[model samples]
Target: MRDPLSKKVVTIEPSGIRKFFDIVSEMKDAISLGVGEPDFDTPWHIREEGIYSLEKGRTFYTSNSGIKELKIEICRYLNRRFGLYYDYDHEAIVTVGGSEAIDIALRAMLDPEDEVLVPQPSYVSYVPCVVLAGGKPVIIELKEEDEFKLTREGLLNAITDKTKVLVLPFPNNPTGSVMTKEDLAEIVPVLIEKDLFVISDEIYSELTYGRDHVSIAEFPGMRERTIVINGFSKSYAMTGWRLGYAVGPAAIIEQMIKIHQFAIMCAPTTSQYAAIEALKNGDGDVEIMREAYDQRRNYLVKAFHDMGLSCFEPFGAFYVFPSIKSLGMTSDEFATKLLMEEKVAVVPGTAFGSCGEGFLRISYAYSIDNLKIAVERIERFVKKHCE
Candidate 1:
């Protein structure tokens, strides 16, 4: 019989993050910090809106781009919070999630062998989506010494004649690294000079500490070429709601909608209604969650420090990427042994990228009490292993 699967699909590896998560699910009494989900429930007002929509029988599909009110709300929300702007009628699209927005944007722009610069460690979806979309993904390994922010030299070094797009995953996943306005200033000129377009994933925009999350699109001349992808998942705790949106040049969003309309009729109608409420009145809820996450983040950093573990302080998102290089064990080896002996589950940093080899990505998105317990287990394991 002939081969049934496409070689392209087969060549892509499944998400390494999920492997440990699956094991922890089946392991009794295991404390898994492997997932990146917020422990908070979707804010009450948002849930109420979804219920109201259902009661009103507003369960049908929305326009392929999204409901007009929701789009307008998204624009207003971005402007109020992050100082970015977009036209509701032309430059916005509602997607199934930020993940879907990333996928469709790559599909809309990439042609075979068109190079896309993907910085790692990042959200796991970028490289595979680039491959499936027929783009050659060129990885730019972000350095810990640089706080994992993409640098001007790195951007210039990665670009070539074939390079067309750059995936900027910021207020980043796994590493919790965020790009400030100054950091963005350094790279925007290079992108403009190289004539490279950008896919800026700003899903964690609301979670940054000390400084605000800066959008590449907010810089001069970048608005026309940068696609900003964001969603209700991390910020609103609306992951299950499955709604996200992209705002970019009308030309790009139009093409993305063409793909979105056929592949997905629209984002879920009920979720769209819920997200409207989320965008309109959910700031307080997000602030509360962000504060809680900030506390957890600080506690984790201190715990690692007290135990003599090497962990950089994360200023955004609810994760801490701690180096396990001192333990004389690979990330995978440490994570596996920690799970087996200590009954605490964390993802190896290599799950995010090859350079993540000596690190572990532990999420602080759980309760303070759970975090304390996980810390105790981890410290015990570290002492045992280090000895």
Candidate 2:
């Protein structure tokens, strides 16, 4: 057979997270922590609303931009939470998930060979989406000593004439890092000076421990250039429902909606209705879940430290990235061996980026019992590997 794949497609690799997932599924009763999905179901009321919508024959596709009511709620929610507002009519579009918002944002903003500066170890999708959209991904390594946060200096260094967008993955995946408004202030002047656009992925905005999540859009001058990607997935435990939206200046959002219109007619109708419920009534649920996660965070951080793994205290999200260098194996090797030997699954830090090479991401989204079991197995695995 002739080489048939597009040149761009050939350069991509299967998600590194999926490799551990495949191995975990093959084992019996593996305590898996490789995925960032919330362990809770969509709250009962939210689920009921979706069922009611379906029963009412609200099964038709929504307007390509999404249901107006939902967008209005989104506007209210963003303004209430982060003090960032978008025009419900023109500055927002519902998408299949934050994933699609990411894709469309990249497509809408990137020209061939334009540069997208991404901080690593961030989400797996950010860089690849930039590539598929015909842009270059410039990954700036976020250091563990900085709590895995991107520093202002690194941000300044990574910028060049071709840099058009920066993917700020705060409340970040894999590392459980978050940027406070004070933390974000350091980068704002650099962004303004460089005239860069920001694609802020804030899906974990509600899960922060000490402070409320802040949007870059709250900064002066940044509002016009920042596209915020948020969803019902992490905050409302609606991951399977696949509802998300991007809010930005109408000009950029209009362009994104055009790409979204052609690629996905609309997000799931039932999910949109459910999301409206989540937005209108789900704040209590988020608080309840966040409390539970906080308990687990405290427990797991202690557990990791007791086991001789140095983990940056996770300030947000459900994951904790612990350095595995003490075990004298690569992060991938540690993750692989833990699954094989102890039936425990975690994602290698290196899966996120090269800066993550000697770390491992352990999600604490599972029940405490399951987390304890997984950590015990990991402790045993590390001791055995170390010996």
Candidate 3:
């Protein structure tokens, strides 16, 4: 009998971030900081829109491209916040979530053996999506000293003739690193010179602490070559709504919409309606949540520092990647021992990439009370094993 599974699917590993989640669920009183989900409920105004839609019997399919109102709102939102614009009619496709946008973008553009440069440590889906799209995953390992920003040098060194696309995950998950406009400008020339396309994931664009999140597409000559993927999940606390959008060259978006049309018809009608309210009226709620997250982020950084842990100050997203290399333990061992002994769970940084060894990704999306409890346990565990 022939094997039934596609070898490509078999080669892919499950998400490393969720490795300990099942265990934590069953372990009573465990405080897990591994998940990237926002703790806030969908804001009442946003949820009310969804309820209103249902009450009005607006529970049918939208167009394959999405309702014009939402797409236009997205364009306005991007322009007002990040200084970028797109043709709502031809260049944007509303997706199920940012995850789906990532998958379909890869599917739309990748040809067999097309090399995609994926920077680490990044969101776990980038590599697998590239592979599943029949592209070769070329990893560009971002360094701690560089604060995990992808440098022009790193981009140039990773490119070969086969390289076609680069996945730029900033306001990055796992590490919470961000690339400023200046940082992006340094690499824009490399991309244009090589004629490489970009899939820029900016899902955490709204959660930055000190500076506004800049889009790579904002760089001159980059808007035409970059596919910007963003959504309401992180910013509006609408993760379960499963709504995201991709904006790019109309040619590329046409192909992505073709894939989305056959694979997912449309995003949920209720979610799309709710999302309009999110964009129009949800900014205040998002700002409130962002402030809470910023407070927690600061508390965790100081707690780790006082405990002798080396943690870089992450200005975006809700995570801190703290090094455990000096504690004489691997990231996995440190996380596991802490969970077993103190009922605290964190994702080992290696889940993001091999370069993430000796570090752990702890999310501050939980409440400050939960954060303080977790930090106390972590401090005790660090003392037990510090070199």
Candidate 4:
């Protein structure tokens, strides 16, 4: 029989992060600092809400856009936290996860061969999502010297006449880099000049340290052109809940909702109820978790430095991108050798993009005890290899 699978799906590479995770899962006593998932459970209040929804028999599917109450809470949370305002009725759609919002947003906007400018050393999904939507993925390699934040020169250099979208993955993954308000200001003119729409992935917005997280959508004239993607996953330790939302212009959101209606119908009913409680009463919980992550962040960065690995001090997210160049090994080789020799698993920087070649992404989401153990193992591996 002739092959029935779509060539596009076959051609897309699987997530490199998951490849290492699979290996680590089967290994005995392996400590993983690979995945960015939070080690914390959903706060008791949030979990209780979900349980309450189930106990009350709220198990039916919601409206395609989601429960109206959850949508209102999402809008209120965005405004209260980020100063972003959207019409809860027409401009917001709760999704299965931020991942679904991303996929449907791209599907709603892109035509075949439309170009999307993606900053590299970003989350692995952006490129593949664009490709799957029949859009062209144009990578703009962010520099380590600039602390992996995108610059105006790089933005201008990457944009072409066909460029239709920009994936702004900030409070970014893998590298844990964040773009400050000033940093984002520098690119507004370029985005305006190019007429580009932004898919601002702010999943880690609540995890920022040292300063408040700024959304590009908050910039003047940018709100109409930006789709703000966020969820309870990273911030509330609600990853398993699979609830997220997208906020943008009504025109764009309407189209996205159409795609979502056929594809997902609605996000989980229990999760939406849980998310309502999250938005209403989860601030203290987020603050507590954020403080914990910040402490671990400081500890891990110091540990990397003490071990002679040069690490960028990440101000956001729960991962640190430490340069592995001094050890004279490619990222994959370093990660592989460390996992095999010391039984501590970290994702190779290249799992995010080629620009991550000489780096390794070590998540700080694990507990202090687990992190301390992982650091010791990593130090031992480095000493054995670097000597």
* lDDT, candidate 2, 1-387, per-residue tens: 998779898888889999988888888888899888889988999999999998999999889999999999999999998788789999999999999999999999989999999999988998889999999999899998888888898998999999999999989998989998888999999999999999999999899998778888999999998999999888899999998999999999999999988889899999999999999999999999999999999998999899888989989989999988877888888888888889998999888988899998888888888998887888887788767
Count of clashing pairs, candidate 4: 0
lDDT of 1 by residue, 159-180 (tens): 9999999999988888999988
Weakest lDDT window of 10 consecutive positions for candidate 2: 378-387
CA shift at 158, candidate 4, in angstroms?
0.4
238-268, model 3: which lDDT tens digit per residue? 9899999999999999999999999999999
Error of 3 at 258 (Å): 0.3
RMSD, candidate 1, Å: 0.7
lDDT of 4 by residue, 71-136 (tens): 999999989988988999999999999999999999999999999998999998999999999999
TM-score of each: 0.99, 0.99, 0.99, 0.99
Model 3 C-alpha lDDT versus the unseen true structure: 0.93
Where does model 1 exceed 4 Å of error?
none
Please state every model's RMSD to the true fold in angstroms: 0.7, 0.9, 0.9, 0.7
Candidate 2, clashing residue pairs? none
Which residue runs of candidate 2 sit more than 4 Å off their true CA positions? none
Q: Name model 4 segments beyond 4 Å from true.
A: none
TM-score of 4: 0.99
Clashing pairs in 3: none
